[model samples]
Target: MASPVSSPKKNTRNRKLCTPPNHSLFFLSLLVSMITFFGISVLSFMPISLQDSYLLPLLSPSSEPFSSPSFSSAENRSQVTLASLALTFLDSEENEPILSNSVMVPLPAHGIVGSNVSEEEREFWRQPDGEGYRPCLDFSIGYRKASVRITEEKRRFLTVAVSGGLNQQRNGIVDAVVIARILEAALVVPVLVVNQIWRDKGEFSEIFDVKHFKRTLQADVRVVSSLPSTHLRSRQTIETMQMPSDVSPLWIRSRFLRKLNGDGVSILKLQGLYSRLSKNLPSDLQKLRCKVAFHALRYAAPIRELGNRLARRMRIEGPYIALHLRLEKDVWVRTACRTGLGAEYDDIISKIRGSQPEYLRASQNMSYLQRRLAGQCPLNSLEMARLLKALGAPRSARVYRAGGEPFGGKQALQPLVAEFPNLVTKDNLARDGELSQYSNRSSALAAIDYIVSLSSTVFVPSHGGNMGIAMQGHRAYVGHRKYIKPNKRSMLPLLEDTTISNAEFSRAMRKLHAKSQGQPEMRTNKRDRDVLAYPVPECMCKHSVNNDVSHH
Candidate 1:
């Protein structure tokens, strides 16, 4: 108090010593300013309703509008500040169009519901009573009658040499059998042509039951394993005939048979002979094609046993859903369905396109939808999952995938697996040795898939390729089973529409496929035959009716 200026300097020195520094105060002010700025920014962008209702309450606790809160404690003030910031952030996010518009529709828990599934759909899935479950036919009496007719008459031996994959070979064999029966020739056991598709050297007898084949068709046509030694000796003397592309019963009866009479044993060298479903064929010959395809083409003992075992393993109390997801690398490449796979997969698409046949390559001018509608491309895994979910396949359904590992492996199958967690394959169910036996044999592996698919309660094919077509035909022939033939062409647009909600998309799909389920109508026109896979009337008969009637 002696000197005023000196006293002020001493006071300042004392204040500096008592209070540490201005740095802490500066940081606190900066943080509060930043939070206020951030909160204002968030609120400015928020929807008007959110700002008035949600943000207003968080920012000002007092009921009076925009009134600054008087906090009793620092904790109260801090709590209010933190809450307002959080609400601002949350409200801002909630107003985002992407999040607000997205709708994830869950699939039916038990099965598909709604008006889409009809009575025929219900009956198709229902388990058959007693022996009706089995698709076995009694061709014994017919075989015996046909046998007597053939043995009594001196029939000319006809050896049909054909080639292709299993289904193609099977189709060829059916056509060959009908040809032999038409010409009244003793049919040589048809050869299963070895090719790069399966990469197996196994003979026809090695994969198929030669004895069963011979025994089953003994009456309809004499199915000999090979050309008789007598015929082999006179091989050079045998007359060779190339089957005309448009072969008919009239052609076989009127002209072809006369060529076989003078020769030691005519060799009918048939190529691409899958045209047995002609509308003009005699009913008996048509029935014979059915008998051979549906009844007589039984797999060998090992294959049958393995297929059954795999089927049993897949079924858990109820019949499993067989998904023939034809997403293998070769098939995918051939079909050129690559669209939304992204940059990483572009090289793969390019490589695949480069390798395909010129005509099959996806044209640059054609749209993705065009390619898909024309059935030139298969549904990608994601699209397949979406379609299945829409069809009312529950997430918990047991799905047995028929084909090999998909093109993209885990990445491609992720969506399907997520939807159907219980999905399985032969590789997962079968023992190492069991699968190893047919490891290199693609056809045998495919046969296993075929058998499992045949035994499934519901069969759905992702694409209408050979495996799918064969399975569809087999399922139809066995009985009018629940075969969900997806109307991919109709469903594609709905899937591509981002504007549509998940529920809306699913509803549209269900409506589109309402009548497409189960055994489709048998198409009569040769051009439309492929649509139904198996023309039911031509290839299948009611088991009861088949057993009661006797062949002439």
Candidate 2:
């Protein structure tokens, strides 16, 4: 204003001051432009199904859409802008449907409605990216598959007789193959030995496809339906070695390796091979475990057909939760916990545990509440009811009961049925004569449950057991399907607190399990941890586009 062009230095200083403001304005416009562009790009590239799911909330805010965001708000607009850019990076490939029953697309933090859930509760339920890791089954850079070079003449034989239930037998069979590879021996089909207590005479061929089993493992280890004629006739040479549980490769080699090498064409039968092998092993061996569980050990066609039929029926209406209602008599007595039926049932369980000293746990000294609090006991119906409700499942949620008959029958399930009226099992879901065929075969029925459970929208185990553990791992391998492992030990205390309101309880439950959902965690080196049940660091690799999710 002081004679506009009079002082050149004054004019320059004023222009420099104006330059900073202009620069700021330029950056602000660029950020807003970039954010708008990114958000639009995400919506444009989204699948038709995902577009409906993610955009419906924005069009109509009455769903409490903004209340619990998939991605929480950033501290500032800059952070918001940065987050908008993140949508462009999800690589549309990750948005494909995993299975028909699974979430149409596994959005990082997509939330379901109507129930009171945490901001990122749906993320907890969503299958993990395994920290960007997916299932990878291959030898490392140095490791290579050297198929059995030992001639048939020098090859020894290892036959395993797996005991317990269907899942126990599965664990044993998986270990048997790795054990065969470790010992450099040909593996005969693992026998599903009769459980002395249950007297279940289920055969290997009755459950699994024998030819498929043989063909699948042919490359890694020589597999046959039976041992040679000589060994079959004179089975005495094949000592029935009752192997101790949790045996290591070193122990296996020392115990049987030298013995097998001594005799020409020696055949050894190992009993109690359930959990007989170490959890930790070489990467190649772990991959073999996955190949065995996911690929080789398939249920017979009939079992699969029935299971699929039930699964189809389950998901026909909508997504369902497969609950491993672990309230069996054996589970009760094993943990010595009250049946919640009454003091009478508790006394009966105690007497059974007392009379059968073997059923008496090493932790027998711990009281029933102590065991329940420690999560050693299966969750009874009431606790399960509370859990499902707290986890965002409404009263109308369809639930598939995935266990044998509860000890107390309808009375035991009253609480759960009261909450989730649409509860069902293979019995009700199957066709007229479908379940009748496998009514007596407990393992076959369990196999049916396993099949249906694996395909469920969500799998919630009442307590940790063979079926539950196996399902959790299988779900993770399949597509990181929603597997809610109840925070029993921790949540039990919270659940027991009567003073705490329902709102408080729900918040606590969600918070406790925030990071426990089927995330990519490597199997701990703990004893008896099944690799098939925890196949992240070993079996699964990162950004595994080649690894396809197994719907079967």
lDDT (tens digit, per residue) of candidate 2 on 79-137: 34433344344323333211111211121222355466454445434455455454455
Would you give me the overall lDDT of model 2? 0.70
In candidate 1, residue 543 scores what lDDT? Answer: 27
Taking all chains together, each candidate's TM-score versus the true structure is 0.68, 0.75
Candidate 2 residue 428 Cα shift, in angstroms, is 0.8
Candidate models: Cα lDDT each: 0.62, 0.70
Summed backbone clashes in each candidate are: 0, 0
Please provide, for model 1 over 1-552, each residue's C-alpha lDDT reduced to its tens digit, 9 standing for 90 to 100.
467566988888878899856898899889999988886676545432223233333443332212233456675565456456645454342232111111111111123345755553444354322122212222334544664676333337665555656777777778888877777777777767666445566677777777666655654666777666775666433545555656667866776656666645565544456654454565456556656776577787898888878887776445568888877766656566673456667578667577655425456788766788776677777888888777666666678988876776788888878887888889989886888888788778878888888777778888776667766665554444567887877776787799999889877887887666663455454543642265444433222311222211
Candidate 1, residue 417: the lDDT equals: 83
RMSD of 2: 15.3
Candidates' RMSD to native? 32.2, 15.3
